[model samples]
Target chain A: MVIFGIDLVLLISALMISATPVLLAAIGEAVVEKSGVLNLGVEGMMITGAVIGFIFAVNTQTPIYGFICAAIAGALLSVMFAVLTQYIMSNQVATGLGLTMVGLGLSALIGKPYEGIKSPTLSKIEIPILSDIPVLGPMIFSHDAIVYFSVILVATVAFVISKTRIGLVLRAVGENQEAAHALGYKVVRIRFLAIMFGGATAGIGGAYISLARVPQWTEGMTAGAGWIALALVVFASWKPWRVLLGAYLFGGITVLQLNLQAIGVAIPVEILSMSPYLVTIVVLVGISLFGHHTAPGSLARPFHASQ
Target chain B: MKFKSVLSGVLLAFGFGTVAFAADVKVGFVYVGPVGDYGWTYEHNEGRLAVEEHFGDRVETIYQESVAYGADAERVINTMAMQGADLIFTTSFGYMDPTISAAKKFPNVKFEHATGFKLADNVSTYSGRFYEGRAIQGHIAGKMTKTNKIGYIGSYPIPEVVRGINSAYLHAKKVNPDVEFNIIWIYTWFDPAKEADAAKALIDQGADVILQHTDSTAPQAAAQQAGNVISFGQASDMADYKPFPRVSSIIDDWAPYYIARTQAVLDGTWESTATWDGIGPGMVSIGEITDAVPADVKAEALAMRDAIANGTYHPFTGPIKKQDGSDWLAAGETADDGTLLGMKFYVEGLTGKVPE
Candidate 1:
């Protein structure tokens, strides 16, 4: 029942729940990078989603609407990044950093009135037959709908990236923008779509924090989850399945560290505090290296087509 | 975040540059967390607002929130002083050395650092004895908890937080011999999602009563979700949870001190001082006790609160041993301000060591 003085069931359940927000954001970032763009404003977009989702959820009293609007808000914010990089040819790094600053400021402004307000938290859904199982059922099947959605989203994204024609074109664009443009693949359009998808996913990820994880609205509540999600994309080597693995690994180590601390283990708190990031980087990056995974060639490079 | 702050600092310098000339005096506030946290920073902002309202056009107040400690804090304080702030309040314990260093640089400018011990000619320190109020919550929790487990969410390993934990645990153990404490050091002053996760982890670990020394209402939301758990509001009265989770709170009132200090600066009588007040001086007032607390427990809690306020009872009254079983306080003896301020060791029954 207990592993290392922690209830294994509770630890696993907490791990899944804790990882959902970051996993969702990472999935979106993975897509964005795979299309040869890096929008560092993931933090900005996330808080925008967090505040917008929280506002709508509180006003309408429907968390689903909150998620819907949050994605729109996130994508809409990311559209700034899309427009600048695609048409204006602004430097992606500076623009992405600006977007984060803008997002934090804008969210604080809009979220002022909604501070300390609780959202309509989603109830856990226990799968009918699976809930009857002993340990794994309770661990994996009893989280809110968002948790399950994130997992399925990862699988769907992985399938699309590896199997679909759309995936080939996006990868081609990331690998060599000029080539993809010469091939008449409409490189700008594909990257635009990818950035928007990333924004939408990151937005939903931000919403998860406000609507379920914290279940309350607070200024800067997304904190640095967006940044971690951004890092997660590179560490996972832009692979969707690997992003999920990285999230769970980070989440699991964190939960384990806290649980062990609660049980009076005398491990230095500083070492344990930094363990999740350390383990996540070591495991995910180590795997990516062995698999020969690397960043997109055109990532963060400004691209424009000449007639 | 640093970029954002730097940009705002420029904007603030320009905006307040004009107002400073017309104003009789300029005052500044430096906060460790966002002003909208609805907790510690919120209360301090309320004090800042009160100063603005009380002084009207004669005084001008400016503040920068969510400022990091160390170099960033020193920079913010230095910026305010350079921009002509006559008095500035740096409201975070981590900003002690920065406050001292900044004060040295700007001798005429008055600086007050909260919950810190260091002092200089121009820098003073002030804090409330929140541990006095924690005793009442401890008694109520000991009586209310069915699980005999109390989870304390501690922010950082500072003496202010450690003292609260020790005082609360000592009282709880006095009432319930079976009571056990689980302490989690989160290392952040305000991060809602992380705070929520910590609260959930504590609940899942069998804690039924929670107390948070951090500045956020996220823990209240977490306890509310757990349905049966009880919690005390921290730094600010999180009244939304009301009769259930947030039964009582220790509210920090800094307005009067801020006003008096500002007045002292204006009057040219400002001197370096250390002020530590508790319920006795009304700086740390206890929030209302909801009916959710059993009548007997509520009465007992209130009685303890009054005794503490009246100075007849001390939360750390004697016969206590250090976690290592060494003598800490002898029978009929109470903790001195010196020992309480630098508290680093846990009492005998606590399970964990004070992290460095």
Candidate 2:
């Protein structure tokens, strides 16, 4: 019974750890899509952040600076997307895809030397009074600052989107960019900021993997987490809290399957290993059938003043 | 006037008499992962460094790490060829097709693909018998484990990884008849986060010993964090962690092979062929056995290594049974390359199926 209890706690902790990157990326993406821009280059941005963060952290032996550098790298890469799509009037989808490709190539080139070397891990923040609580202490309070930051970000984003005027304008741009443009709202600028914000968050997400989760950079380490975040934006119906719930839900599935295999569950390892993705797809299809009413009016479409 | 023209012509001929030598031999390396990964790529880079160190003036080495084994690989190879590389080494199994195609495109350049079988006249294949190292580690794990449950973190379901798991399990079972091997396929060669998660999961399930075919120190770190789990280094010597983790390691010594191959090219005797070296050729080396191991266990492991090296014993000798208890190898028979290369299932002692 004691072993089972420990296993359960470990599994939950694993879920939280796995969900941190996705949550950070998805929430930022939520804000981006909320502001009327769909950046398909989240994966690319995350990978770029991963390599840059790894290089910075490895060189300086400071994980905090690594994260900051990662955010900046992600933001810089996003600016390229912003310039092409917002300024030059290129197709947003094409620009975003191009950004991913460029980011992938650039990260590959830059990360060449830093591969395989472990980085300094982020220090954990043990919540003082709450950490002493029996089951939740180690699982929740004993996590690194990133986990708590993600939770706070989710709450802040949820509150901002539902209750604030700036979020109202962002939503207005997403709902009807032409109308927002007519109102002197500067739709392109708002969307650009949204995209940059998303990029920055995705950067943190990527760094979370490199600096905290894995604490090392490997080629293609993001491993479709960016895509999962993209899916999550839709799955959450563009709501912040839902995004958090969805990320953790998916994270739980991922952790559970591995734990199930570990506990010698009477199932094929391959099937268990694949179950998380399968479950995500199934839930996605189910949600699609049920109709996600909160989807952005101009989700994937590029918004142009002339259009 | 005729004398003046003769003098001018002789002066012009003297100016044109100076000649220049050919450029240095350019060698390019395409790695599947980063050079610092402390595993497969790290070992390969060590070999690259060795080549540079030996033929500093005669060779110019250039490498691009983390080249994926698909269209990107073809592009990188083409780029290297265009850059005037005389030899290219694509160091991954997935690079087999791309390497072959690139070799055909650049006939002047020699190509080497690690752990791949298909080769053209301009292309060669090379890999160390890593299973031998795994077998030795397995022997130690079997003898040392308080719980007879061994966990294997496999990178992929490919034959190379399968061979390692099977060989390790075979040796472990030989030592501890009650040993049960559990495998978790992480489906990637280099995701430390997933690798750590896998390690933790294994430890949680009462596996005191862990082995991995993936690259990175995450598994070792994970074992250390777990506070009692033991693990072996994947590709390079990781004994720095010592008694806590990195109880033993399978060091990939590609430097000698790389040096020899490059030297052959310089000497103009390079040829396309397949080379698979084992313990005998020093390709597979064991790291310093930790003091955590029982003295007797360490001695036994060394004895096994010597036997494997000296041809006195074969790890995969006959009288083995398939998982279904069918005869895999008859008595006095060793496993043939044909069987070993395509091995997918565990032997009779193993309980689980090789998931499709």
Candidate 3:
């Protein structure tokens, strides 16, 4: 029984660690969606960041700089989708999907020489006395800087969206781009900036996986984490705090399922293994039932000047 | 006018006197997973490195990782041929048909598909008999498990994975008839999170011993976290987490085959042929048994290993029965390559069907 208690604590810690990547990705995606540009290629962006980050970290022996490079790479890749959907007036969903395929192929090509090599890992940041506080310290405060950054990002995004003028303008653009444009706002510019911001965050999130979480880059390491982030945007009802909540909830489910198995609970392994996906589906269904808010009015709908 | 005629004469002479560039031997590799996966593909890449190191000046190698098994494989191989690949190695069972089709298209190029039996004159096959190692691990699992129920985390329901599960089960049941095997097909080869979940699920089902064919450290980590549970490393020397696993492992050593094949290419003796080596040829190696295993069990495992190496004892010998109580092999008759290659069902003790 005592072992089970310890297992729960360890499970929670694992959940927090797993949640960092998703939180980083979801937050970046939230900002993108909030600015009225739908980049469904978050998975592609993340994987691109993962390979580039891994290669750079391996070559430079500095994981931090690798993350920076990853962010830049992600933003650059996002530019293709930005150009296609924004300038070329292509369908957002199709363009994003195409971007994903391109990102996957390009990463596979560039990542050839880097196969099987381990990259530098990010160092954990312990908050001195806070890290010594029994189970809570190791579970929360003892994570790497990126994990802390994700938490801070949640607070900062919430604050920015609720309190700042830029937030209002961004919201205005998302809600009704034509109205925002009519009101002397540069709607396209705002959305582009927001899209870049999302790309940068997604890149960092990917770097976190390669540099910290798994601490190695494998093909498709993101493994649909980007899709999860996309789902999280809807799960959170397009709200910042809710996105954090949703990411943690999913993260917790993932960790808890593993923990339950670790503790030697008497259940069918297949059932236990399938629980996380089941929980995700159930939560999504529950959210859809109760949370009835529509998506951003300008979401996925390109705003051409002619229109 | 004389200067123009002289220039023209010089251009014509130079054109006629042009020297031909020597063509490099073009080698291509198709990987099932990203090369960065520190297991199967990683080992294969190491072999590629060995090839490069041996014939650096004469051979040029190009490879694509994370290639799928279907139509995409055909496209990648065609693309490589178009790009001037003379010999291509498609390293996955699913790559069999694609390699065959591509071989037909590119008759000038040699194609080697791993773990597959389908052959064209230009398309050959190669794989290690990993079931030998699993037999030893199954013996250990039979000895070590406090609970008679053992869990297996399988990748895809292919013959390769099926062979491992059957071998492990056969050995386990030989030691302890009460042993029951439960399998969880994760349907993926390298998702750590999924693998971890699968390991955990096995533990939840009261399985004190676990074995996996997936490519990741997640299973080992999950087994470690489970404290009393034990597991063997898949596709690599994962003895790093020893004592907990404690007994045996099946390590894939692709370096020798890769080096030999590349040397053959460099020496102009390279031929398309199926190559499958077991423990005898050093293709399959067992990691050091940890101190945690009981001495008697260790001795038994070593004896079995020696028997396998010396070919005195066959792991899949006669008198084995299928799940339906049908005799799989007659007494004193070793299971032949045809039966083993097409093995699709479990021997009586397993509790699950081969997932379709």
Candidate 4:
């Protein structure tokens, strides 16, 4: 049950919980990148989602409704990025960065009234029959609805991106927008939808933190997790499944390191503290490198149908 | 209206506006966390607000919040200096070196860095003796833990945090010799999610009492979710979660000190100084001990609080050994200010070395 002073079951459970937010954010970002749009405002949108979701949760006393509103809030903020980059034809990098700044400032203003307020929490759903198993059940089958939702999201995104007709058009648009346009595919429209999806998931991710993880509202509480999700997207090489891997790996190490420290295993706190980021990036980057996964060709490129 | 505007502009050009501006003292504040954190930075901001309220138009305060540590801190300090700030307060331990470096370049501009030991001719250090509070929390945690495991969420390995750890451990060990401390160095002062996770890990590991040295009520939230676990608030009165998870709190009262320091500046008597104040001076006050704590334990904790405030009992009194079991203080001898300020080792009973 315990190895190296760490309870494996508790450690994995914590990993699942911690990884959900980043998994949601990265998976959404992977889709946006696949459509050749790099909306760099994940931090902004996520925080906006965190505060909005927290506000809704506090008001409605229902975690589910808070999540829905949080997703909508994230997507709505992303629409700002979508407009400037897609319709007005502004630079995607600059526009995304601006969105992040806007999101941070806006969320701080909106969350002022909600500070120190406890949010309604999402209870864990232990799957029947499977949750009865000895070690595996408690570790994997027992988690909140959002945790399972995150895994299913990765699977669904993977299925849609690789095995569906929609996936092919998305790839075509990201690889070469002009070619996709010449072939009568709606490049801008497809990218817009992808940006919205990314925003929605990011919103859910932020909501998860406020509603479940910390279950309290504090300004800048998302605290750069959005930025970490942004990094995971690139490291995963625009793959939905790899995003899950990177998030779990990052979360797992983070929890493991803390547990190890708690149990009095001194492994150089500096190295241990940084191991989550270093190990996750190394392993994810290694997989992407060996797997020959490159980013979408038109990533961060503004598409103009007029040449 | 144009003629009236011209007449007013001409009157203002006659040095009336300039006369008022000459008396204005520009003060700057640099915060390590969002001012809305409702903890460390929030309390510091309360002090800044007090300065504004006390002086009104004679003093103008501008603050830059959420400034990152290290190189980012240097740039923020430089910007404040370039903006003609007469006095700047860098309110975080991580801003130590940056504050010192900035003070050197802007010698005329006074600097105050919190919870750091480094000083220059122009740069001063000031901090609350929060360890005095940790000692009380330690007593409650030690006596109340059914599991006998006390979980600590430490932000960094700085002397201030280290002092708190030692003071808490010594007090806890005194009350209950079987008590065990599970210390987690989170390396961050204000990350809510990590703070929550650390609290959960401690709880899952059978820790019934949690004490956080970090900002935010996430740990208290985590403790509340776990049902049986109890926690103490740090740097602020997190009274929202009272009577259960948040049994008590260490409220950082910085308003009085802020007023005193600002007055010193206005009186043309401002000098580089180091201030390490505690409950005696009201810089660190314990919040109401809730019903969760036993009546006897609560009374004892308050007695200790009074003893500490009146200088009869020092938290770091003698008969203590270092983490390595070496002599740190002899019987009846209190720890000197210099050793406490530069504390880098744990006390005798606390497990694990202080991470530098």
Task: Using DockQ, give the best candidate's number.
Answer: 4
Interface C-alpha RMSD after superposing true interface residues, each candidate, one decimal: 1.3, 3.1, 5.6, 1.1
Worst 10 residues of 1 chain A by lDDT: A280-289
Candidate 4 per-residue lDDT over residues A152-266, each given as its tens digit: 9999999988999999999999998888999999999999999999999999999999999888888889899988999888778788887888899889999998888888886
* Candidate 2 per-residue C-alpha lDDT over B123-183 given as tens digits, one digit per residue, 9 for 90 to 100: 9999988988888998999998889888888877777888898889889988899988877
Q: lDDT of all predictions, in order shown?
A: 0.90, 0.85, 0.81, 0.91
lDDT measured at residue B112 in model 2 versus the true structure, 0 to 100 = 91
* TM-score per model over all chains: 0.95, 0.84, 0.73, 0.96
Q: Tens digits of per-residue lDDT for model 2 on A1-307?
A: 2454346667778889988998999999999989878889998999899899989999999998898999999999999998888888788788888888888778878897776566788888889998898888887788888899899999998998889988898999999888888998989888888888899999999999888776667667786789899989888889898899899998888778777766666788888888887887787788778965567887666777887
For model 1, how does the per-residue alpha-carbon lDDT over A1-307 read when each residue is reduced to its tens digit? Answer: 7876788999999899889889999999898998999899999999999999999999999898999999999999999999998899999999999999999999999998898676887878999999878988898888888899999999999998899998889899999999999999988898999999999998999999999888888888887899999888877878899899889988788878777766668888878778997897678657766887879998888788883
**CAPRI tier for the interface of model 4:** medium
Rate residue A264 of model 2 by lDDT: 62
- Residue A58, model 4, lDDT: 90
User: Which is the better candidate, 2 or 4, if ranked by TM-score?
Assistant: 4
Tens digits of per-residue lDDT, candidate 4, B177-265, equal 99999999998999999999999988888899999999888898899999999999899998888988899999999889887777878
Best TM-score among the predictions, by candidate number: 4
Model 3 chain B worst lDDT window (10 residues): B15-24
lDDT of 2: 0.85
Worst 10 residues of 2 chain B by lDDT: B15-24
Residues B74-145, candidate 1: write the lDDT tens digits.
999999999999999999999999999998999988899999999888889999999998898889999999
User: Per-residue lDDT tens digits of candidate 3, residues B1-356?
Assistant: 99999999999878775423333677899998866566677778888888888777577789997787799999999999999888888888888899999999999888888889998888878999999999999999998888998988888788889999999998998999898776777667777656766676677667889898987766776676667888887777665566565345788888788777766766778787878889989888888887778999999999999999999988999788898888888888798888889888888766645655
